[model samples]
Target: MTRMPFKKLALSTAAAGMIFGAALPASAAGYTDVPKESSHHDNIVRANELGIMTGYGDGTFKPNGQLSRGNVVKALGKYVVKHSGLTPEEYVKTYGTASVPNFSDVPNSWADQELVMYSKIVKDMGIFKGSNNRLMAGNLITRDQMAEVLARTFAFRDLPGAPEISDIGGSAYAKSIEILFENGISVANPYHPRATTSRAQLATFLVRSYDKVSKEESVMPASFYSELRKGKVSDAIVQIGSTLTELKKKAGDPEAEYDFEGGIRHVYGKYEYGVPHPVLEEGDPVTTVTYYFDEEPSLEEVMRHMGPVEQTEEEEDPMEYDYLWYHKGDFEVFFEYEWGGDTIDNVTVKSNR
Candidate 1:
């Protein structure tokens, strides 16, 4: 049968949960090139785990490599398939073997016919408006184009106080970049709107977008399974006293990490784990566990979960926020309230000794 010509390519963030929800057996960053110091370390590693972004056969993740239209569609397709609540077997049965719409440039002999099929879904979704029967799959995607794609995918809402980025003056995608800025997503330091987006930047964009996208999807998309991705003290992967080694072994590489106080701090979305001072190099017995929420939990809710507050202390930066402390045997838990607020925005577990 003769295949019909296709029109476009694009994907939705709603499909990311399925891609990253499964259990990972080992470290997310097995790449030889990206170290903890690399700016792209966190995002690249996390993206790797999600299968939304990946490296070549070589043991290197070309963080600085430029992305092509073909690769972008493929990655987005993986995200959607994972989050669509269907297993690989189901996807293969439904999409892989099903009628795949063909792009003019993406030939029948393409190495991965699966990717060709994914582009079909993306085009069907209207992200890829392949002009003149051509889906320049080998062409690069500019930073501006990426912004437009993400804005449409995540349905970025207009927020106040958006930053003005450079190089998009009269560009058609200026509005898209504005939406990203308003939504608190930065593209790159230079904001090179016309430049091709790098692998590192793309990974960072996807990882950073998880929260924003989840919040926008009111029905509560199954981005990850509750059993697979744990949070909160009751279901947290790591505890107040967990060793750094244990944290890494269980949680994989953090999306962001840094040296804080004496030990190290790792950031996984809104969750932060820290181990400070003495035995810092050995990386054991975590010193703190902190989690932030988009909305502050009420005092009553805090008490309901953690019992009565034992003490309250005004922050040294008194205008910044206040802390409500509750003792848990040798451990201490604190509810942090932003100044002039009625509820708590963050909760932390730490050593009382």
Candidate 2:
């Protein structure tokens, strides 16, 4: 049987507009300790409103308190998850299972499960890193590490006109810190590269980042599922029932060919350009068109365009790879996540006939 392929979804930043919305309303939610007079009070309430950070059970958010690595991960991870274009519940089901519990210092016991998940979430998403192969959950996050986190989170680096900070000299964060300065997260004189970060500082950074991270230019990759249902992919104009002649007319001569199912599989390039064989003859209707991405697309970027994923009752997916497949009258759309759920490996569209 021909292998059934599936892919994970990805992010479209506009979906998180609320995260980057206008100034906090006068009636917006606030913490006990977050007075309007506080320097970071607006950002603190905004962060809390977005669920990126929260207050203590006593209703006080100690903004000036030092943030630990675990707390940092939790804050960044929550922001990523919320903006991933998936609802909190859907995000958990779609991405929560991919977090590998591998932090040496983070035990798999019930007590540390949340920490383990957030630690793995930020690590796998390339939002944060650990030291000496340890998560260092209890250690205070420094200015440099926080810079790296925000840089990775918003995909910011190499701001051409960004100002230089003399104090970050020779530090790894020298470049990434430019994002903070470029985006005006902080314009502190003599930026402290090694200083421990406070919750207030992190909240300020997250709030200030809204403009850059939630840019209107951010959108979903082309909808493979939608195109599949329409019987054609964007790059290749021919539809599923399209003849090899039509494909050749549109996509040019094949670069390679091999046995596919019972028919000949045509390959145009190294990527999954187009494959239209599930039969025994040279002349047959195109069976499938596969689009390959050089870079792995995130589930958030893909799903927003591909539409809702099919539901399964299973609490924890037992499959080795994350699979999301869809079926219409005569078409099948699939995206398989080989490495993990956040990054989609490939998307394949096939004629059900």
Candidate with best lDDT: 1
On residues 1-353, what C-alpha lDDT tens digit does candidate 1 reach at each position?
11111111112443444232123323564678788898778877777765566665556777788888877777665655555456645755643424445777876678878667767756544455566867788889988888876654554545555466767786787777877777667845457788898878887887777655544323212332211122225445687767788988887888987876676778877788887755445467777887776665554334322323458776566578877776545667777887645567877777655
lDDT scores in order: 0.62, 0.61
Backbone clashes for every candidate come to 11, 17
Tens-digit lDDT track of model 2 for 6-89: 121222444443332213322356777778898899888876665445567666777788988887777665555555555545
Instruction: Judge candidate 2 at residue 83 and give its lDDT.
Output: 52
In candidate 1, how many Å is residue 215 off? 4.2
Q: Give the Å shift of residue 288 in candidate 2.
A: 9.8
Error of 2 at 84 (Å): 3.0
Cα distance off (Å), candidate 2, residue 116: 1.4
TM-score of candidate 1 relative to the true fold: 0.51
